[model samples]
Target chain A: MTTPAGTWNWLTDPAHWAGEDGIAHRLLEHVVLTAVCLAVACLIALPVALVLGHLGRGGALAVNISNVGRAVPTFAVLVLLLLTPVGRWGEGPTVVALVLFALPPLLTNAYVGVREVDRDTVRAARGTGMSGRQVLLQVELPLALPMILTGVRTAAVQLVATATIAALAGGGGLGRIITAGFNLASTPQVVAGAVLVAALALLVEGVFAAAERLGPPWTRGGAR
Target chain B: MPPDDCLARNEWICGAYLSTRRRILLDATLQHVRITVLAVLIGLLLAVPLALLARRLRPAAGPVLAGTTILYTIPSLAMFSLLLPLYGLSESLVVAGLALYSLTLLVRNILTGLRGVPEETRQAALGLGYGPLRLLLTVELPLALPAAMAGLRVATVSAVSLVTLGAVVGHGGLGNLIYAGMNTYFKAQVLTASVLCVVIAVAADLILLAVQRLITPWTRTERA
Candidate 1:
């Protein structure tokens, strides 16, 4: 029975904006969940990708290993974890699933980023008496920063989208808005919730795209 | 073992769950395959023209690419909710949302593939009496297949994963099982459905990989 006008009305209502289930609260939850997942994923994935990329060997193996789980949808992982003992701890399953989901792209890009550094550049650094560690840090890291950032950009945007599943696990996020609306059979409310999440995701994407494009000189402007 | 034993024990891996739910599982998998295939195919269809337009017109490239990437950043739930008004709570909503999701991967890779076709190759084709349309069909498109297929493979796999989110809309293929089972803590049901989802995704990816190689024999020959 709800119409587009109803959706507008629902969005404009201050009643839905000020309580525990308000947009502000849900937005906070979504941001916190996504940030936590991305931070944890980066800590785990970056070092492995960077190191493997520097060594110039086994980068593919490491990336592929992480990717084996890629075929399994993140939501499925979240549900499986919830069905386990891990679900006993609130928010635990969501975190674990999101972290795992974010790993593959982060690992792939970080590894490829560092590996893409010109071979001759590394060789020149080595011939100049730079240690392997120094070359990795001084030569490879800087050039790879843009590509690594590309990975982060990809992971962050995806995490924002995926983190909405946290709401399904009874954790807080914008997804609760939509699910709650569904329970109430309010299509307008549901559309409003969708709008908020989509706006947030696009905003995140825009910010990261800007960061990647306007980053350091080594940042390739396009075609990553 | 008794059919209900696994259910009674709340096991994570249960043969009984599969045996008992075989028909249900098959239906869910079929729905999942249907949704994923439809979404990816629709995505490919949309991507070709967009990629072509982008390559053909330099000014259009930025917007077309940006638009698709922005679409991608919209979280799956949000995307579905946004489309709720248009398609209601049905498989079409899920398919439309997923098709949008696939566009970023599809468009980017196809564009890359198209651009990857060497200028020299185009010149050769033109020199040999190939007009624009003919040149595109025989020379440009064939060269772009490897990249286009790569994109398709990625889009297809991710679609399988994302389709699980459709459970929220009441049509998430295997996601419906996982979603329902999670509510009552049906461990056997949840695990069985998830494993099937993984299997489908992996199997689809392998098939696509084979297709990519088969179509782009020249790529292999060059590598060899």
Candidate 2:
């Protein structure tokens, strides 16, 4: 039977599989970019959010600031950076924009997670002579694990999706394929690229969902 | 300075760009706003009924929720490509993709809000001879406004941001400028366009927040 459209043909072509602009190379670039951004964003966001939650202070300030940051679209940030000196440095602007894009969900979820830990449980931990660090690590962090994972999941999916926009900055990603398709006026290639991106995003989401479920048994809601 | 001196020199923050390109920017922004607002409104219209359906029929809750979640997982680039065939590179393609993206947030939040209505409150409303529709409209919906508003704010901000991606199709309001600017490495256009997208997203979020607060004054007292 004939293929429904050129989409399948474009995707299955052997020549598209080789060279620097190949699907594999672009996919790798997308993943590496996403991973690096997620790592940096997590490093920056998790500690501050966790610390603030541990100290039981500054929820309003943190959440409000992050919300404003979140409001700024990632696309604008990516494009703005592309015009800067740094944007010329290859992946710098993309990484920065993506990191910024990923920060809000990570920050908000981790903060809310740690803060939402039962107050009595925390007090008891302190009463039992646990240091503030101990309470944060042993009591709050464990309970907040699922929530933090949730933030990670959100950030991961968004990063995978938005990393495609990085192609507009001349950064590598599956999005490059779509943009290239547009340049060539090839609907099939564009559709094919979109399918790959959507698949990757969904895959990342599923991985994170599994990760969330893999949290301590308490995440499943049994333990007190 | 010549009217287009900044464009010639490629300055990042050119007053000349703004003055010379005001009409273009205004049109882009208006398009951006029109698409974003339309997407969110359509999203809410669809999401409310879906949320109500999920709430009304326990068996449907899983599928309805899962479907939106899957939709949300698709990357914006891919979402547009997948939708290209249906909408044929039209503005409606972008609007439809954004609306679909907003569905997960809207349906989930609205459902959560509706579910969160106190059982006693619902029961009391029922006992008062309030018809089902009246109960939903007057009591349940008002009570659900806070959660629903939270989703709306997020959906609106994201829509404002994502509409820029529509530039891939020559329909991405401010995104078109950003896209064109990047191709030419035109500093002023890219920076100006990007900043405008952020400003729009931030302003839209603030407006939604104000609307939420205005409509849900009870939440303020409850907090106090």
Candidate 3:
């Protein structure tokens, strides 16, 4: 509400929503980048965490190492990548940087979720003639589902927000709108861009939260 | 000047980045540290009281948690754009935004730590005629230190990286180096700043870990 008139005007303008530089195009770019990066991050992080959690070995070390990604600025990593050969491929560096940033939450959540499962439950599953693989797939994985989803939710929301940095590296995303607004000194346009990003992040959070509620009753909190 | 030789000549390449602007680097690091520490400290202080209030008032917990969670989900770039109109390129906007971001984590951790204290311990403290204030200070806080400290460690790491993004709002730090480096295609500057950001994060995290260990000695001992 800082510049109520200007911000309102920008939000209502049909031109900002209809063309190549319109909100639709930018929103699609942001969504695609977010989805691609998140999918790749999940692919890389989920299996490692699950296997480690299933094996009950080296999970802590892996989690700790991945936490390093949290400490390193994604923007910094993005810039560094942009200077390397990876930058030559257009959006490659940005995607890699985003994937790296998204890893810690997914890895930590999955590992911790698995580790937190009741030992007796595992033992009981084993007693029921379940093999190690069966115990993991049938018991531990189910129990860990909530935590894993929580991690995914966290990463997804974060990626939606942080993906804005992709624009800084000449990659297409909603961040370009804000930066473009800055270049033109259009505060309302910048504000509008921020609103879109925040709204998208909240939308992602809501979807995951709803998914969590609609999940199997066993995975829900208070089920125990 | 081959890529392989550049990688092998580690010191030589690093030296190129540090050849000039030593003063600028030092100043930027100090600014980065100052901004991060200040934001987190303020967040921690604010979160404790809010958390205590939420614990005491059950009806308030839902709203308080939801509000802070929403605040945390706001994308950094948009948060900046929204804030720019109100705070206008000042340190206050960045600190305020980050402090708000830290609250959800810190408050939840504090609440968890407080709740984790055994009911028997609380009863004993009450039976001893200990006042609420005294019991909280001597009994609850010490027990809660571990959880609170864990929250602090995460917040500090996040704050360090977020401070770099504050450069976008003109609050200069190591992020400014990366920002300028990107604009100029200067690998040396980008590399130096990114590495320093990681180093700061890692060092801060380690120090917090040490502090947590020192403060929670009972955690290391078994209850025979």
Put down candidate 1 lDDT per residue, A1-224, tens digits, no spaces: 55678878988889888889998899998999999999999999999889989988886586676557667888889988987789899999999999998888888888888887889999999999999999999999888988788788888888888888888778899999988988887889888888888788888878887776676667764235
Q: Least lDDT summed over 10 consecutive residues: which range in candidate 2 chain A? A: A215-224
**Chain B TM-score list for all models:** 0.96, 0.96, 0.91
True contacts kept of each: 0.80, 0.75, 0.86
Q: Candidate 3 clashing pairs?
A: none
Per-residue lDDT over A2-113 for candidate 2, one digit per residue giving the tens place of the 0 to 100 score: 2236888888898897889999898898889899999999999999999998988988977886777766777778877777787777778888989988888888888889
Q: Which regions of candidate 3 deviate over 4 angstroms?
A: A127-131, A222-224, B1-12, B220-224
Q: What TM-score would every model get versus the actual structure?
A: 0.94, 0.92, 0.92
Q: Model 3: which docking level applies?
A: medium
Candidate 1, residue B221: the lDDT equals 86
**Residue B37 error, candidate 3, Å:** 1.3
Query: Candidate 2 docking category?
Result: medium
lDDT measured at residue A186 in model 2 versus the true structure, 0 to 100? 78
Enumerate clash totals for all models, in the order shown.
1, 2, 0
* Superior by TM-score: candidate 1 or candidate 2: 1
